[model samples]
Target: MHITVEFGGGAELLFDNKKSHDVTLPEKDKEWIIKDLLIWIKDNLLKERPELFLQDESVRPGILVLINDADWELMDTVNYVIQENDRILFISTLHGG
Candidate 1:
């Protein structure tokens, strides 16, 4: 299955273009979702700060993950059932100046 991954803060990427795309759950793509997401996050955001993931925190300080506009904490998390066109937004939490 194919899903459009849209990062918050104006980032966008597409995946699974080798087969017919649909909204249903693709067994083959399940594991890839979590692994791919971590890879994306690590590569895109923490490339310069590889120690981010090493910290002991639940939600982290500067990262926010939203699935289709809703917080991932409210969803199934990494196991959340994803669909075609589902938007994944990774936002950086902002603090007061």
Candidate 2:
């Protein structure tokens, strides 16, 4: 499946300072969910300080997750099923003033 993954508000610093990625997830026996996508991202894209992005299999506090422009919390958060061409965005709200 093809998806666009984005990071912002300082989260990009942990991903090589790049803000966007076009990812093609491998075919699998089961459908992909946000929880699974998190692992895939960590394994394939995260560059450093994973603790800043993920905590106990989910995003750390102070990060806002959006799916296709909608709040991920409205879409079931980490259990949201992924679909073709979905856009997943992670924006950090933990910035220092």
The prediction achieving the highest TM-score against the true structure is 2
User: What would you estimate as the lDDT of candidate 2?
Assistant: 0.96
lDDT of 2 by residue, 1-97 (tens): 9999999999999999999999999999999999999999999999999999999989999999999999999989999999999999999999998
| lDDT to native, each model | 0.49, 0.96
Clashing pairs in 2: none
Off by over 4 Å in 1: 9-36, 40-47, 53-61, 94-96
**TM of each candidate vs. truth:** 0.50, 0.98
Q: Give candidate 2's TM-score.
A: 0.98
